[model samples]
Target: MSTTTTEVLAFPNIKAIINDNGTAEVVVAGNSRVVPVGETLQDLRDNALALVVAEAKTLQRPVRVRIEDPEGHGELIVHPDGKVESVSYETRPARHRTAAPASTPAAAAVEASDSAAEDVAPADDEAAQQAVAADAPVTRRSLKETSFLVSAPVLEPATQGWRGALTRLGFRMNPSAEELSEREDIRTVSQHWPGPRTIAVVNRKGGANKTPTVVMLSAILARYSGAATVAWDNNESQGTLGWRTEKGAHDRSVLDLIDSSTELLSPSTNAAEIAKFVHHQTADKFDVLRSDENEEGDHEVTAEEVDIAHQVLTRYYRLVIMDSGNTARAANWRRMIDHTNQLVVPVTAIEDRAEAARLTLQTLESRGGHDAELARNAVVIVSESTDAKRSMTGDALKRAKAEAQRIADGFEPFVRSVVRIPYDPALVNGPIRYEALQPATQRAWLAAAAAVAKGF
Candidate 1:
């Protein structure tokens, strides 16, 4: 649980002692705060943002930090923000391959026939191959976004609308302006993760836009990624993720999934059987796992229960976006965080919801250890509150932007990225149809979803 930061600490005048809880006592200029393992350096840069620039103005050498981790190491470039700006890699030596002797035409024909047969393997063989693929080492660097890219030939320059004009002339189809950004967004969301990667959208406050954020992100990934994605409401009692999502033929909840999971998890069960318990969204193309609706029932979703449900989910989904209840201390909530690979904290422009988001990040940092990494790399989304404001007046919009910026500034020191979601009356309340949102609002959610996808 300890992080050995500053392997060489002669300069930078900073020191961190990571506690077993996953946080470290980051000391700089006799000031210290308990922050996540990966955030100590960020805190240093935050407190010294102006000081560092001023020192350079006064002809001083700016401080720097070199960071290393279990997965390939990289330096912590001294940028005031502390987010990973760039990583330099030393290429691995080429494997020495013994060239195969020129095959006879008959032998080559035989090999080609075998390769063709391998493409249409049976379901059992496909599952076995996927299982083996899960064990392959992941070499992505830590504290960096995971983006899978698709390349295409470039003809006209993408800048100044040349690409768009060429497309009008029926020459090249390079996306530009909004289209270009959307294309890049699809690339980030299209990553083919070997195992399931879950994103927990959490805030201890009820009106922090957690469910909507989960729904939008799930929809975005499901629509563009060409893989199965599911949004599971892991609340102890009831949740709204399924309510807001498009209704399906079945009314089965997570409890039903848990009950059937034993048979569903068996190798003999139909691969499609898991769908019986999940509700499918039509336009979004993702599934939803509803929570237990009984208000007075003693059946609280437990950590072990979540684990079982999660196992069933991973078999069918590449990404699982979770909508959590307000109780941060609950077993289900903590379990969600434990299983999560990326943390996306959704908040509103309102004061209380913003505080709740901040407290959640602080709590995770104090709890420290593995959770620290989740906290440090968490993406914070600030949405304009859906209260009576009703998309605010001109001056009110200015104030809202200021408020969103203030919240973003507060979160900058702790999280990897802060995305401000603009106010859209369509998303004020009720069912969120991704296509129904205003174009601007859709773009905002797309940006937020893209940021979330990077952490996958």
Candidate 2:
């Protein structure tokens, strides 16, 4: 007989626990790291949860463990954010029945919400019928599973958002290695970010496509996730980021925000008031904060000023991509690096540009501090700096391509990832429109952006 039980859990880490004996001691682990058997039901749940959360780091994916006991059965669901949802139900004592194979991971879809159910692509009718035919009769225990799964079920790889659906329909038939890698990158980029994250695009070398990276990456993140993102210029003096982007009505720059940061930081300031200093790129759906472009305005940005401005930015944006000046030793530049959670180092096809990027990584490592650790996990982007309308397949082009690849390859051990961007005439000079780039160039930028997002 199937029985119903009720239990509560937050992203529970315990996948499955079997009641071994009447002693009431829950032996939930394989190693010496075991939870002490508790005196009461509440005590048992708390102790088991502590053990599961601690062991969670070793698991590949968050699991929903169906905990079976003599009196009842409980289910624990762990969400991507590591939050646990646990449900307990009562079960009647009966002989055990054979359970279904893993193919029916979605079998517990009864308890899922309408939105979550919609996220699962429809299963093949023929396959569904076959699975049903081969399955045993649903027991009372299965009913409880259904209720808990509907409430909060961890999506398995077989039912992974879009890719799995395509695979099931025979859409993704035969994919090349690059195609597969790019698909994985896209999935990684589109992940749910809980809060604001920062990416600093730097090389300490001008003309390395730093500004373009900041623009392209932030645009991709916002366009795909529908979240607010911003590109910030951390130039100590003057920078052309504002020049290459669409200008707003006001001449507000980073300094304007920094000067008024005291008011901006106040809890009373509304979002509209705080947004006055930011230049919104309407087409790309991301904002830009540039340094003063005036020749006479020679005021240098200090490290403390950058911090104050950053605090204000975090209040309004989900992601921040900073473009640095040519000089790496500036106070603002170092501060930007300090606050950066992910580092993106851009290089070009030119040997000097590529070498300069490599040297920047080396210098970071030489700093012998947290910067060294950050450099080791940086993403390197190699962009072709030419102004060619079509891909140039000349011998010189081939050689440069090979050299750039070689340069990127050398950093495989130290860096998180490296991607090469093809030359696009549209990107050579002028205001960058994300839609204006060639299809190939756009795809390359998407790949680069995905790589940077994954580093976070």
Q: Which is the leading candidate under TM-score?
A: 1
Q: After the best TM-score superposition of candidate 2, give how far the Cα of residue 129 lies from its true spot, in angstroms.
A: 35
Q: TM-score for every candidate vs. truth?
A: 0.65, 0.64
**lDDT per residue as tens, model 2, 1-456:** 222233222333344443443122223343333344545665555555655543443343445555655556867654333467655566857754333434554434322222343454566544554454455344344353232222222223333446557768866533333454566667777876888898999987788889988889988888887778888988888887898898887998998888898898888988888568888899998899988777786798999998998998998888888999988889999999888899999888677887888889888889978899889989998886574325666886877678767777876777888888887777778999999999888888888888888766
Error of 1 at 90 (Å): 31
lDDT of 1 at 234: 90
Q: Rate the local accuracy (lDDT) of all candidates.
A: 0.73, 0.73
What's the TM for model 2? 0.64
Error of 2 at 371 (Å): 0.7
How many angstroms is residue 145 displaced in model 2 relative to the true structure, after the best TM-score fit? 4.3
Those runs of model 1 whose alpha carbons end farther than 4 Å from true positions after fitting are 1-166, 170-179, 295-297
